[model samples]
Target: MANPKRKWSKARTARARSNWKLSVPGLVECPQCHTKKMPHKVCKTCGYYNGKVVVQSEEQD
Candidate 1:
């Protein structure tokens, strides 16, 4: 195995990690309740997916 010849500088390390950020989750409006949710996933608010009730949420009880 090979090792690095020199230690990386703090600024350089910071610059490299600057782009290592968490991106906001992609959310789209739920067709059933019109609330924001992840695309193609069941809506946590309504427990629905693709216009069908995949999960029986608390509100539905």
Candidate 2:
């Protein structure tokens, strides 16, 4: 078995991790209810997706 001849440096490791990041979820407004939701997904507030009801949302108290 062969082992690594050179140890990985901190700068090199950090540079590789520079692009590793968490990105915010993509969201869009529902045309029917004007609520923010994930693209192509049903709006939880109004239960509509692409002009069709996909879920029954409960009334907010």
Candidate 3:
């Protein structure tokens, strides 16, 4: 088996790790409820998508 010829430098390791970052989830506003939600997904608050009710949502008490 082959091994690394030399240890990775701190700067090089940091540069490589800099690209490994957490990205914020993409969000869109629900047309019916005006709440933030993931794109192309139903709105939890109103159970709607693309101006249509995909799921029946329970009314808030």
Top TM-score model? 1
User: TM-score for all predictions?
Assistant: 0.67, 0.62, 0.64
Sort the predicted structures by TM-score, highest score first.
1, 3, 2
State each model's CA lDDT, in order.
Answer: 0.87, 0.80, 0.83
Q: What are the runs in model 1 whose C-alpha is more than 4 Å off? A: 1-9
**Best candidate according to lDDT:** 1
lDDT of 2 by residue, 1-61 (tens): 9998668888888887986776777889889988788897778788887787778756632
Candidate 2 residue 57 Cα shift, in angstroms, is 3.1
Q: Write one digit per residue (lDDT tens) for candidate 3, span 5-52.
A: 769988999898987866887898888878899997888889887777
Residue 15 alpha-carbon offset, candidate 3, angstroms: 4.2
Q: Can you write out model 1's per-residue Cα lDDT over 1-61, one digit (the tens) per residue?
A: 8988769988898898987866887899998899999987889999998778999966776
